[model samples]
Target: MTMIAVCALWGMLFSVLLAEPVQAADLIRALMFQEAQRVLITSGRGLVRQFPDGAEQVMTTPVVVTQLDGGMTLNGARAASDMVKVRGRDDDLIITVAETPVSDQPQDRLSDKVSDAAGSAVPPAELGPPPMGALRGPAPLHTLVLAGAVQVIRRGKSLMVINEVDLEEYVKGVVPSEMSSGWHLEALKAQAVAARTYALYQRMMNAGRDYDVVAGVQDQVYRGRRGVDERVQQAVEATRGVVLMHQNAPVFAAFSSTAAGPTEDAINVWSKDLPYLKGVECPFDANSPYYRWRAELSLQDLENNLRRQGIAVGTIASVTPFSFSRAGRVGRLRILHSEGELILRGTDFRRVVGYTAVRSTQFEVQSVGRTIVLAGRGSGHAVGLCQWGAKELAELGYSFAVILTYYFPGTEFNNTRFGAQAPSSTP
Candidate 1:
């Protein structure tokens, strides 16, 4: 059969498997690499490349994609075009990149990178570190097995790699990447639903953009088919096409590692008040490793980080909690510096200091000598569902439905086909 005929047949088969009519929104465009200069892509079972002008070709060897002056180069040969789409013939697409080495010096430990809107920085327990790199320097190659078609689009001087995959398959990639598959079956189910809802919500919000969600901590960690196991598959299938709905639309459905104390209010964290994201007493996550931890950073380093973010500060003299939220998490901080004083929001403070360093805003600050010591509870921003809390609840025999309702109060379950519309107000 021709490629067009085969693609039409596959579409019909996919719709039949779904047991529902497929729509344009049923697919998720996940941003895998943004503005990357180079990437290595191949497939074990042959590959198919589609051009912008509706042409296709089959390849059996690996292809290196690099940005050019105007267009791009395929294996050092110019393609004369700015965009290309590639997919595996019958196997998963493998993307490879060289890994950057981590610095060993203590002074170089501070990372200026900031977390996304959700402020989730905790790594998945089962899937160690994500296969994350844009390939800047030469090093050991790290391979990522992805189950979707990748679009390589060149914008100006750099190239972007986006994975366009089925919504259900996207959720499967997210479940094991966010939470461990070995956890209670109920917790995994809850995570599956949340991941699905969050993805749909993002798709709705980003309809005007090129992609829906990013495959990283910025959005939800999606490692394609890397960590998917039987349990993860079961969890996804059990709650297939289900999402948390609020007023006939999917909620933001934010989640985090641990809410050591009470879950936070979205109004306090992101300044967007959703009726379902109210704070609630959460005492089930004490077993979490990040429940209570201490992070110390030198005053000089803090000042440097603050300056890097365009916050003018001469030398940090003292850092004190200026205000507290209703959940008792720090709301703002008063920094005394050589120049003067600056009031920084707790969320901005977490951004200035690495998310991994400060962990959460529910912390006590102590300026001892030349270092600032922070004793904090919780991981992530403490908004919406708490994964560790859900684990404990699942262990205590709570059903996934009950766990989801407990975290996202006043939210109802709805099929993705019906309730995946954009809300009247963006969260």
Candidate 2:
């Protein structure tokens, strides 16, 4: 049969999963409005509060928000003058300079009335990052581009600026950051669903915490309304509330750039062997740039890595692969030294040897004098969906649902429940 016929066949395997249906379009507002559907994204340093008039605020007396040499840091005033950093006793956010409060609240002064009647709801057109793209001056002077509103709070001594936004809106920002918008629509849809699921999982995990998820690599990259493509927005809306589930719980839905040969089991990377995260072949990923790679590290550099991992043995002697995972990745390895030997899991070794340099756990180690060579396949922990593989599949005429099931087997799809507050377990 043709690829389209095969896609249709695969699609038939998944019918509506729930007897009581829930619309994907309204899933966020219906199930998670109580939870606020707000993802707490960590704002980077030097986040200028850009107003409708183009005014910027980088600091507030005691609150010194600077790049700090291109790092995320917000401490007391720097050496701009004679201001000293003061540590407050209580754990609330305070914009204070030395001892006095320095409040720089955003000004909301609109000449026109927001509504025809007081206490009436603001129309849908009026809801967005306040006057960001709105024309300000007489000359149609400057169009202000910005992320959504930022909520600044203190996490201990430092101020944490969070971008609190609706969960579906948050997915639109993530799809572009995680996958290129120029790729196939199905692949973008897969990314959207995965990101949405991951966000909900994080929400459930951090429900009572200060933030649900961060806007960094640690969670998912989110830049509010900035850089999001229209195609990306369409993909997010298409998937809507759909999420991967295993035993009625929202699967962690881990994903990576490429899986050179086959995806890995969760136990290999995170040490958690969930039901849905089993090894699966991904032959299409050979089209990825990271399909095959090699890294050469000096023996001394390897020794430095050992020391950084708190292992001391002077110099290295030999390296050996102790064990392998089911997906053909190194599960355990031995580092022989002149004094003794150190045992390490493949993921831990990759961390110590430099994640970028080592690239992946699937590699062969060979020593050529003072240099140690590592030849590997793939980039990132090959756990769930292989993005490049998905793109290739989509290009080959597979639907998003078919693509998702190909990567993650045994998970059913339905707009109902949509994986929010997923039942503790489902078969």
Quality of model 1 by C-alpha lDDT: 0.76
- The Cα error of candidate 2 at residue 57, in Å, is 19
Tens digits of lDDT, candidate 1, 1-427: 8999986775565335334322335789998767567778899888899877778899767878988888899988998777778999998999875543121111101111212223233433222334655324454566778887888888788777888998889989988777778788989899988988898788867979989987766787777897788998999888878777776667889888788888889998777889999988888888777789899999999898988899889888899999999999999999998899999999889878877677789999887898989999988888888888888888887778878888888887764333222111111
Query: 306, model 1: CA deviation in Å?
Result: 1.2
User: What are the TM-scores, per candidate, against the unseen true structure?
Assistant: 0.83, 0.66
Quantify how close model 2 is to the true structure by its C-alpha RMSD in Å: 16.6
Candidate achieving the largest lDDT: 1
Q: Clashes in model 2: which pairs?
A: 62-97, 247-425, 247-426, 248-426
Tens digit per residue, CA lDDT, model 2, 135-157 = 22221111112233444433333
Error of 1 at 96 (Å): 2.0
In model 1, how large is the Cα lDDT of residue 134? Answer: 30
